[model samples]
Target chain A: MDTRILLGAFIVYSLSTFFYLLNLTSERKNSYGRIAHFLLLSAFIIHIMSVVARYFIAGYTPITNSHEALSFFSLCIAGFFLYVKKIYKVEILGAVILPVVLVILIFATAMPSDIRPLPPVLNSYWLPIHTIFSFIGNAIFLVSFFISITYLIVEKGLKEKRFSFSIMRFPSLEVLDSINYRCMSYGFIFLTIGIITGSIWASNAWGAYWSWDPKETWSLITWIIYAVLIHNRMAIGWRGRKTAYMMILGFFSMLVMFFGVNFLLGGLHSYM
Target chain B: MSDIQLLAFGFNHTTAPVEVREKLYVSEEEIPSFLQELKDTCIRELVFLYTCNRMEVYICADDREKAMESLYRVFCNRFKIRPEYLSNYTYTLEDKEVFRHLFLVASGLDSMVIGEPQILGQVKDAYRIATTFNCTGFYLDKIFHKTFNVAKRIRTETKIGYNPVSISSMAVELSKKIFGDLKRKKILVIGAGEMCEIALRHFQKEGIADISVTNRTFANAKRLAEEIIGTPYPFEDIPLLLTEVDMVLSSTGASRPIIDKPLITTVMKKRKNKPLFLIDIAVPRDIEPDVNNIENVYLYDIDDLKDLSQKHLSDRMKEAEKAKKIIEEEVEKLSRAINQVDVAPLISHIVEKFEATRENELKKYIVKLKNVDDDTLKTIDILTRGIVNKLIHPYIAMIKENGNPAVLETMKKIFRFGEDDEEKLDNRKQGE
Candidate 1:
């Protein structure tokens, strides 16, 4: 039943992504964005149901396996996206962000989701705290990454005196830049707390506060990149193309930390 | 009484020069008395639309020639122009042509600047004034209502009014395209000239609050700033102030370029490479042409703005064709409705006559018969009613389907449906 709900959410999210893509290519119309928003909200509700159902059945938060973790990451992204959309009224952001959610969901559905008893090593309250904060932070960064990408495209088009569909569809550079900064700052704070919680949990579970595991190292790397970006933006007024480039780099590092560390590096964090 | 005819006579920018239109222009204070005078004339119903570009009168009357003559006499008397002089500039239309002309005018197709939107508002104002003066009857009321609907339909269904033709509005549109919202953006106006003031007014209409005005002559800039509720800054402070503003509108009388690429590039550095939109509408270009090549700067001169507005005007002209098609369709629909009204009484009269005769004969027979049951009486009544309906259905259908004037006239003459009776029926319908 949980898988069915997750699959339902996946299908709806795919449809929502299709609509957002259509909105991106077509002449500016509010109807396409409205439909996409409705579908995205529906998918978010079903996804919450799936996660809550798994939490009830398995007797723990549902971030145990790679499948569950990736799914939760995508869910957080959708949640943050809907929140930003409500607050900012930037409907065109979906064109850049929804496809990323779709890809994550597709990868998540491909992974296995089976009921597993909690291992003694994983039986701690800190598990949920660490994963939840980390995933939320990652989701926020994902949004910033896409917004930064759109900003770069629009900025380039304006600079070159060539107005394309993308240039016409996206919001102004100032708006996009402000949203990117907001996401980066919020994501930075969440990741800081997440890293702190993970260290505390590591000490409690493994008798160490720091590990040289690939996931741990890559998370640190992503953190450093964002730290530099936020610092430069706030202190030195680093903005426009440079900040946008840093956001893209930070998001890629996060992708590697989330997926590569589990599949290729086989670290102690591989269980997730 | 003769058949009421729809009549429209007008002088527009195209038909007459401004001097002739000025001669017939009606002030707002004079409209009520003018309408009273028109009501005293042969026109039973009338609406006078007076605007800067046109002076038109739409009337409903029993005799078109008499109404026209009276209107010509009134124009001569009111404006003190001879009938011969007025005749040289005035054009007249009647019936369906009148409807087509009014629809075209309401939809902005007949505007001096094609597809301009203010004429629709002026038409609505004329309608309201006519209503207030009790100069509108059913025919004029229906036409104005239909006109408003056609105007709204054209505005929505076609792109007739989508583009801005004026230079000031075009500048505002360009700024909106760049900034998304002008409310938060800061604008600096250089050289308090007429064009700059007009563009500032457009920006004000767009709800822009943050504005600064600068000029070589500080007193003029201060006066313009006070008028537009903007802060006045000295001209030499523009380059320093440029770092804080998102857009610059310059219409100064300068022989040399007031803004250059190096100046904007330095400002861009201070702004951290944020975009800047510069509009140089001065005749002798206020901003350097090479400023457009600078990064994060979009500069448009007066000629460029004119070209953009011209392009938009051409786009509206293309959409005007679609708007005309909509008006044509609406005119046809309105004509059909009017025709339905014309023939409705005749059809109803024929049906009423047949039913009354059938009822009279049935009543006489019922009295002659004895001990008639209720069911039998009902059956007899239904049978007679059915036969009468069947006999009259073809004629009613024919009159309604064709609604040809000749057929209506022939039927009216044959049945001796007097004009007084038709007038009574129309009034009765209006009361209902």
Candidate 2:
């Protein structure tokens, strides 16, 4: 039963990729898109079940160790995006979003084990708070990344005056710009909370609260870039392409924090 | 006989010179008369669209060739040109090609400069003209509605139409740069020429709706007012209008500079240091170029519209592409709908034909025979129509299910009308 549900989720994610690409290539995918949305939602449900099943086999929240943490991170991002999309109808985000979620889940499928016990360093209540907020921050930035990439793609099309036809489906520039701004704002707040919680956890566990770990440094850099953008947007009345460019750069800083700090440069937080 | 069609003919600055274009331009008074005059043009629908850059006669005809040729005659009569003179300047397209042209024009792709909003208003004017003339039919009106929709799509989907600063609009914006806002701005015009009219229209479009037109002659000022729909004051009121208006444009046909530096300086001090914008579009000199130095006044001739309008193409391309993609998609969808509308009736038509034939045969041979009238013949009538309906259900069903939308109607027509078979085939085909 467990493997069947997991397999169903994996299949659902894979199919979502195909439909997303199909929606791009063809214009009248009314049925195809509905099917894709349904499949992604089902995948999300099944993923939830699989996580519950895994936790039943072991114990605790499936977010402590490396394999479980990465799997949970991918699920959280997908779930959040799907939730926001339901409310906002920001349909253009689908082209960038679905494939990334599928890719992350597929990567999660390659991991070695189920959820395990947390280490002593992660035993504090502040640890889970730090990780949850960090995961939320990651999710928000990923959405920002989606919006920023759309901005670049849309900007290129507008340059060629490619705003006609269904060649590349998109929302208006104003809407995309606004969505990116909101994403950055939400992400910045969560990032601030996540960092503060991480600092508290570090102080309780290691006695040195603000040592410059790779993730901490990269996140600070990401925060600075976004802060600059927000300030420029608010103060100087910066708009359109300039604001879009800065958001894209901030996402790069986010990617460095998410994947680079963990895999390449092993940090103190990489025990699992 | 199949679906709706469209045809258009006109020349813009690209096709004709300024003299030819001005002669073709439709004044406000001219629109109603032109619409009334086009009643004789042998068209199912007619729209006389006249802007500064172009004048177009859009029409729908029962026959495409006949309509095109008749429109040619209408043009020659309207412009008073011989058949050979400038007849080659007009462009024509029909059906979907005509639809594509209309969409592109409405979306600002076919403007003298791309993304001009005036073309949209002109298109709407043409539509109004057509409706007023009672020349619009089902297809031409549908085409116009779709054209406007596509234009809106391009605007919202792309950045192509954003921040458009035409030469006239740049004059307005520059005026704003000198003055803070132009809500109650007083505007002075040296000449009552076409450029002045264009400038007035631009100012109105840019929200500087309050305007006072001053021309050299009282007669010309009145005539211009009647045409441009602006209040015209005498040339004596020029300095007074100057104090009231924040901007002034001079396109007069003067041989020498009219408003020199000293003349504008005196006017500016009277206005209490209020910023003024002056635009010189005359060849010789109407307002001296040295008036640009006048205190709290900014002046630009023709060259400045281009300088401020260097909006980065690279920044606009993404949105423009998105708009075009939307148009193409809509065109495709509309084309499909048009094709479906074309094909559906034919298949239904074939089905009806079969059923009618079965009824006719039954009524002739047995249904009308009262001598043999009983339950037997009544049963035969019901069975016959039933068999006919059953036989046709699959053939027409196949036509509806065909993948190539273009051929669906042709296939339906063939099944309905092309092949004739013996009457024996009906019942037998049904049983099979």
Put down candidate 1 lDDT per residue, A136-251, tens digits, no spaces. Answer: 99999989988988888887766554434566567877778778888989999999999999999999998999988888899999999999998887765677677889999999
The regions of model 1 sitting more than 4 angstroms off are A8-42, A119-121, A153-170, A203-212, A264-266, B84-88, B293-295, B355-391, B421-432
DockQ of 2: 0.02
Give the true-structure RMSD of model 1.
4.5
Q: lDDT of each model, Cα atoms only?
A: 0.85, 0.70
Clashing pairs in 1: none
What ranges in model 2 sit over 4 Å off?
Answer: A1-57, A79-98, A115-127, A141-271, B1-16, B24-26, B34-128, B136-432
**Best TM-score among the predictions, by candidate number:** 1
> Which is the leading candidate under lDDT?
1
Report the Cα lDDT for residue A164, model 2: 33
Q: A18-113 in candidate 2: lDDT tens per residue? A: 776676655453446676777778888998898788767765565666666767777777787786677656554566787887777767767766
Clash total of candidate 1: 0
Residue-by-residue lDDT tens digits, candidate 1, B375-394: 99999988998898889887
Worst lDDT run of 10 residues, candidate 1 chain A, spans A159-168
